[model samples]
Target chain A: MTPLVVGTSAIKRATTPELVFAVVRDALIAHAHDRTTVPPPLHLQFPDADGDCHVKAGWVTDTPGFAVKIATGFYRNPAAGLPTNHGLVCAVSARTGEINAILDDQGLLTAWRTAAAGALATHAMARPGAATLAVFGTGEQARLQVEWLARLRPIDTVLVHGRSKDKTRSLCEAFDALGHHARPALADEAAAADMIITTTPAPTPVLQARHVRAGAHVTGIGTDMPHKNELPPALFARAALIATDDHRQCLDHGDFGHAVRAGVTTDTSDTPVGLLLERPVERPDGAITVADLTGVGALDAALAAAVLRELAS
Target chain B: MTPLVVGTSAIKRATTPELVFAVVRDALIAHAHDRTTVPPPLHLQFPDADGDCHVKAGWVTDTPGFAVKIATGFYRNPAAGLPTNHGLVCAVSARTGEINAILDDQGLLTAWRTAAAGALATHAMARPGAATLAVFGTGEQARLQVEWLARLRPIDTVLVHGRSKDKTRSLCEAFDALGHHARPALADEAAAADMIITTTPAPTPVLQARHVRAGAHVTGIGTDMPHKNELPPALFARAALIATDDHRQCLDHGDFGHAVRAGVTTDTSDTPVGLLLERPVERPDGAITVADLTGVGALDAALAAAVLRELAS
Candidate 1:
């Protein structure tokens, strides 16, 4: 049998970001429901003059279509001015174990899957009239957040805040072309927005506790590694709900890790985003809601599997 | 940069079984001399239907230009007519993390490596002018053992024993074509040969203590799993020197496992094959010698790395 060869360009042309977002959302939900135990991924840390570590995470599910992999290369910082996070997603045939696709769009799948996590969280926790959206970080993920959030909520205005004003303004203009009232805003403007999405890799807190409004939903997908932080621990102290993709990973690397270390949140009962994504749960009325997404291997596998199915069909 | 792709046909055409056997022999010698803390390989078992299981063993080493994988799949006899043992060797590039070559030659690599282990043991343990050879099993590994033994030692006669007379005759013909005096013989004929090699996947002992010649050298490579046995425990009691690729693996799975269980051998201080292969060691003169080779992932990785280097040049 001929091996499947799907590239990033083909994946982009075949499916829209919105459709991929939706498929990824559903896949994450299905995986959340699956109770099968998977082996912990093998971790490989390379020994070099400069400390550059690569974590190879693998998950094989008995899904009928394919065996999907979400391999992310995290080079803390290379001397060559390359992005710290850059890698590819591979989908392989289950029967023959042939790699069918290489979606090397430089973390495009990562951004989409992360954005889907936010959408899934919104579907489970956010209020019905979440019209005002605030996104921190004017990079590719910031653009993806706007595209994916618009699919789940009827947003009339989006507040864009970044370290660079010119980049944020350009992002706002792109959002404006999508028929939304998007504008560069101060940090206070983010607090007033109904839903706040942070995608910056700031080493320090970018979102303050005092700026956030009551009943505001906050989704942080930036602080995936231990050293990165976008939200302060005090922010989750009064939040009604704090959810995360994987509680263990969050406690080790996400904003929840800082919160747990600071003695703000101790229990892990409702922290797992998978549990919240699968069912409609009651969010504390008029209380701040937070969802910390560190990303998971299963989510990547799911999205790759979904993309493969759509392309084959 | 374009990725390197070396398929089974390329490997078959570029390197002969004899050359591969010699390459492995030299690798074993090099590895024995290299001082490094080598750990036993990790095994992953998959539970299947009918109370059977599939095993996957992984070996990783930090040796330069050596990061290959040896994955074997074994299944119990079922209604399907698939071979009980089959798998592939994936040779990966250390610099780029790309799989450079795949050898799917019906486990030919395994047979060649095993034969090389036997040859290494013969060089270390056999006395001068030891010529007569006896092989148990008419499989691919049996053929490899005959050819490799002929290349290493001055062997003019070879006795072949197997359950199938037709297969034994055919294998004898192939060996005879290689300019050796070869013929089909009974299991008792092996007793007269100066050197013996066992390659069958028999669940019970195929070579008893009485069938081995005095002062002869024996190498068994088939009983790598706990449930498989090719040589009786009595043989272990008689051998003055017995070595293995990995002492821990042999104690857990190879012929040593059964011997230890039956109280035939109490100590394993001198069992690691590396000690014998690296330097001249003290052993009883004209005593029976044995080497158990369950295969090692580091060796596979090293051989794959060598092959990749050769291909690149």
Candidate 2:
């Protein structure tokens, strides 16, 4: 039989953020247990067009199949009145090379996976009894990260920080609709919160060491490309433990690369969140812990496996 | 709008091998003139499962758009009563990153492009008044190679050689139906033909220097993988000139790599077939010339453009 195509709507209906969290969480733990493997993503860049395509693939030994994602980002699409991102994921049997399904996700899965990774990291590293959460950015990832993090933690208020006050106010209003009290705040005000999520494309450091509260847990999901760095080098230096979604990737292209380059850290042996999930790290009550979620391929593969299983049933 | 779907039957009925040859020929000559560009193909292999997937993308500057082909080959598929090869070609707009159409050609386009390339090379490199042709291997390529070459040059007979006698005879009979006088022959007889084409996956050389007739033109299409070599290194030494589909690719993985490794010739600056098309090489009356047609991505892109053009019309 030909490979079935799972469209965006079907993908949305088949799995929730919580469900994705569970699958991704388990896959990470499995990877830490040496049960699955994902290689670094292959990037194709057309700098002249401000376009890029990331080809990611992974396999879980315990699952029925694997997935390869073709994700594109046209940074200049907003000027053309089109969506900034488009993606397709192909599921194939791990035992054989039979392709099972092609998911025309339009970057929805990518968004969900990013948000899900945020939630997973927060669940594993966030301080117990954390209440107020701050978000640094007003983009789609900023919104989804807040939504997913809210479901995983108890927070009745969110501190919004944005380069543009209008977008920040809009984000605050969106947060209010979701039954959370949110208000625009300066970088220092947002950084003082118990939990912080950085989700912007800032070329310079937005979250510095001085602004971070002592007992806070900060998640950085912004600095994906070489030019973007959301957190300052000193921020990583101050954290008692730094966890990256994929330690290997962060060492190469993620936020950790910046820190390594600045001479703040010489070691790439920062704990992988996968390993952290398998063996929880004991943090002191006043220690600042940072989680860098640069994203990984296993999340997509696991979610694709879940969707295909749901469709089959 | 959703991407249009063009299936195998549509691809087959919309164009002929001759049309594909024309489109591919013009594209190659244009590329030779530096009017088109194609990136190197990306290959994903599952060695344990004996499956491989090749991703090829290319575009013509003068054409409307570009194409990316996903071609798969599972060597052990016959054990499960499945075909060994499958493929899909995505036609995409060059201006935007939007995928325009997904052609489910099931490797039909791949086959056509390869055969079309053979015809193009033969047209450019064959000695004047060439007649009898010989094909080694009893596979789809063997049959299609004969068909495409018959259209490019004047030939009244074809000699077939294969490891299996029954399959070789079957190939000859199939050729007979195409109105060509074909008969099973040993390696020496087959090699003595006016032109010889090797279309097999033998790890060792199938066509050695001793077998080839002087002044005969040869085309090698089967040694695409790193481990496969169809023609012996000595055969290259006997040729007056050698041309490859892509000079960059041949130097790395094609038959040229083997010859270079065996110390036959250190110079890799062989002329590209595209250049041969644009400026026909003048070979003395008895000088032999060989062309390596290691199926290129441009051929697929050109044919896809033709198919889309036909569909639009």
Tell me, by lDDT, which candidate is best: 2
Pairs clashing in candidate 1? A244-A273
For the second chain of model 2, what is the TM-score against the true structure's chain B?
Answer: 0.95
lDDT of 1 by residue, A125-168 (tens): 77777788899999877888778777776888999999898999
After superposition, candidate 1 runs with Cα above 4 Å error: A1-4, A13-30, A33-37, A49-62, A65-150, A154-273, A285-311, B16-139, B154-276, B285-301
Q: For candidate 2, lDDT tens digit of each residue in A50-90?
A: 77666677767657677777766778888999887776777
Query: Per-residue lDDT for B301 in model 1?
Result: 62
With candidate 1 superimposed using the best TM-score fit, by how many Å does residue B171's alpha carbon deviate from the native?
4.4
Residue-by-residue lDDT tens digits, candidate 1, B1-313 = 2223455566556666556765665566555554332334433333432222122222233554333232334344234554544444555433334434444444555656677777777667776667788889998789977777677667779899899989999999998899889998888887557888888878898877876877888888888778898888898989888887776778888887788889988756336676676667565666888887777655666556666666666
TM-score of chain B of each: 0.83, 0.95
